[model samples]
Target: MKFADLSSATDYLASLTRHGVHPELDSISKVLSELGSPQDKFPAIQITGTNGKGSTCVILDLIYRRAGLRAGLFTSPHLLDVRERIRIDGTLVETDVFLEAMQSVCLAQEKTGVSLTFFETLTAVSFLVFSLSRIDLAVLEVGMGGRWDATSLCVPEVSVLTSLAKDHTEILGDTLELILQEKAAIGRSGKPFVGTIPPEVLPEWERQRSLRGFRPLLRGQDFDGKWEGETEAGERAFSFSGQALSGTYRSSLTAEYQLHNLLTALATVSVAPWPVSQETVRGALLHLFHSGRWEPVPGFSAFLDGAHNPEAAEHLVRQIQAVRQENGKVAFLSGFLREKDWRSMAHIFTEAGDHFFLTVPPGTNGVEPLTIASYLREQRPGIDCRTGSFKEICQSAFNWVAGEPDRLLVVTGSLYLVAGVQKWLSGDDSPLHAGERTSASPPS
Candidate 1:
């Protein structure tokens, strides 16, 4: 069926994913060319990495908006509405605008006679929407491995890679070297690049830097950040010295990993050609709140974190352990996609607690809850693992840790699972509530 409105349009786009990933960028490039190359109309800042890409992009978007610029942000795998993927001036683009852009993108695809994958269509839609809105700058986050991802077609003013890890090993290659090579390829020739790469990947990234002939803004060499201590409000306070906005920065984010992501964002914005004042940068961080990353549910004791991969899972376990009481019980309500390294991640959680309830991520690609529970059992023999409906699992987890000040309830594994719980917590139990756009603020 042809897409007739916003709902149908999103469904139609979702349908394209069944055809599998088409990594080549020729089709997206053709669609953009047919649409008059809207991507070229504005300056873009490209962000790519195995982890922390979405959080970093969101922080950069807020910072850019506070600088008095109409920033356009394009990120992937929206927690709620599909419109969340594309935002103008720190707000989601209206449904009418999103529909109009999708319509134009479909028309451009027809004219070019080139098939676009789900992400490719969204990439085109973002470019079209940004062009129509006359945005001052566009922040594009690479959907996956960046060599031929749809967002790689843009010519970025600065490329920021925030910490590479072994998340997409099946597609991007299993080795860290191979993965870094693919991600580092997002760097444009003769443009500034910044990254928080590991020492093992530094040689590969440096090689790419030499080949691309761009000035390198590295983490250890060009900039350094340290977590000083906690603020009076119980928030994390960090200190960094770099060419960008540097000082003792304070954040309310509960995860320690966010400190590195924030520094990477600061480095990117500092090197950009735009004029962003220290006051603006500070103000942006003060108001920053991206959902599904250590986000607390409105009226629940549980915290939601979308740390599906092993690298992020390690960080999450540490954060939980840091605040958890010595004898407090920590029950986990979690789900995961099929392709993720759930085994490695599941083992990491075993160290934090043995109480877990696994559920499916609400989609075709979701691994069965029973399957994940079985894996957890194998990882930690005699662990308390349960599987059932989303509601039952959530209620059970809450009950397990209820009213105990030190006892913790965590909804983790996948962002989709977190979104599912967020919907249920809002008094709307339907998983499809994410796609049902109404007159409301962006999720969380």
Candidate 2:
């Protein structure tokens, strides 16, 4: 069935929530095959890891565009529009084009008699769009673990695993070793599998690489980066020396952890067939921006970051501590999914903020704000913790931190929560409002 418009198309895709996340690859393979295997039309760089996958994808996209290549990017958990998940030449895919691709995928699914989950359908849509657009390169972010992720259907020219941590434990695995094993499966035999692995899991990563027969380009041993002082314009400056390329670059991204992502992107691009000059890489870094990741809210002394898991929370806490040292009262407006380790995150957050405003994120499985507040109170009786709806909590947090130049409010925990706060702040009343959309459900 053809969708009459973008709204109807999005609604139809959203309705696939009933199918949930089926991690196996058979369904996606069938759907793509029906579409003439568009994913094979162009070379790709596939990225997977517990964290930094999205950032690495965006960085590679920017670098490719700067180098004058038609690049297609596919990343999950869009903050606003579903169309944001698919981009060509650094711009969101046009509505007409998106609808056409969706229609094609729907027709393919009908012919195959296979039900596709939200992520699988979108992945097929991305592949079709990229092929039709004749993109020079495709940067695909695995929606979840790499082994059976829909995006893994392509034999990427380079496979990248950005910093591994314990996340999506319910699906990926509980320990770092198990998680690495799953993510490392994206690597293809004889192709470059470039990324940084924790020292503790080096042996497990080695076993995975040996079994898969992928060429390893491990960080620190084969390549590495050193953080230089910020540029005069406040951009991050770092020097990267690797086996394929060596250069000093600057980035507009603020967080310290972003340096790791930049390194991964550079390494992947350097090894892939794509020929990006050092000058183009330098130019791309200066304009990089990933919303809802340490992004400063307009007209407010606040920032929004989607630090949902314990590892990410630790990064956010480090940033908060740095801000505090610079003389600001740090406060948090946070929410999380029920499946995440909220207790560990809560304990970690205490090192950064004294005031907490809790609210439920959009969609199902959100941890109750009152429940988080009670836990926080039990842990630190003197700490101030409040609970309410997203709007109520945001307003109260704003009021509490306003008018003080040194006071900063951080809205974080889950990307779903960050999206809701961002949409409310921007005054968008669309049905995809973060409060109403169930797009945050885990996608395998």
Candidate 3:
């Protein structure tokens, strides 16, 4: 099979684990062992958290690339292409190359009777591609909690946690302590577990580190970054202590909370024990780009942060505090699966000043537009918001933008929603055709 024949890697992996007896690490580890442990050759930075994992991975890729090294980045649930899951130096992999890698992974698994989950197969395929491509460093984001995620197979040079929060309660445990335990699973015997978590999580984190025998780089304790000021270019100025970088300029992604994620990225970059420089951090931060996180299209602004759960909704609201505009109606194009906290998610972002554009991506997890509109009215009465096909919503938003020219528009609430809008806006077919209602399924 060739790269062009590699369109449905997820489908192929899904077939293997369709009736998953379990999602365990040991089975995945043993299978990788049979395949020659391609992950062992992939030296990388590992990041896990309820949010900000994708942003951190992007920053790591940018920084390492700036350091004159070939960087491979593997993230989840790509917006446009499966190639987005496998990138070198911030660019998507070529079609033929990616297909070859997937073919190789399929061939490797034939000999290892133990089946790998969708995420596990994707992770393994990424490692195989990165290793064979001669990547100098790979940045791998945990697909879920660190402990059992397929990416956990390697011992990363820097293990980073970015603001622990509640998510994936069914697969992980129901509480924060249990959630942190699952997330902290990536920490190896001696690798430094660097984090930019809030001070409130310190006590529980320290206790866990002691038990795991992992070295800790707690933010504000081991290393920290200071917000210098806002630059004339409208970008932010900040400096790091652990990495010893000064006057670093950052063009942020998603939320201003991303500033904290950026700080952790720098901390990991600084303490990486490899020959990386402050200049590299600056260069990387300057060019660092990740789509679907508050990305803006021409004529209309489209913010694409996935606010599936309550905590993410709160964070998105907090990040929006920095958004300044004199006047223009605020409207949101948002929707989610029936299982999520839809009422709370919408309330946090639907303030006194904003209008709403209800949308459901064409996916299994997608909440119907009218259903969302019904919920929105139940949450807050008499607020006029459009509910319809995603393309119709974008045209509505774009038309609104043409009139106001300065109004703020946000398209969020679900990854499926983002993928659909991204595909439509870019003039390509929306990937919603691939949507599987995972959020509505019974607990694993």
Worst 10 residues of 2 by lDDT: 435-444
The lDDT per prediction is 0.81, 0.84, 0.70
Query: How do the residues 225-266 of candidate 1 rate in per-residue lDDT, one tens digit apiece?
Result: 988874345356788789968787776553778888888988
Which pairs clash in model 3?
3-99, 330-355
Best by lDDT: 2
Model 3 weakest lDDT span, ten residues long: 435-444
Better of 2 and 3 by lDDT: 2
- Candidate 1 whole-model C-alpha lDDT, 0 to 1: 0.81
Give candidate 2's TM-score. 0.94
Score candidate 3 by TM-score against the native: 0.89
Q: What would the TM-scores of all predictions be?
A: 0.94, 0.94, 0.89
lDDT of 2 by residue, 155-261 (tens): 99999998898888888888999889889999899999998889999999889988999999988988889788843454778989886669888777757778888
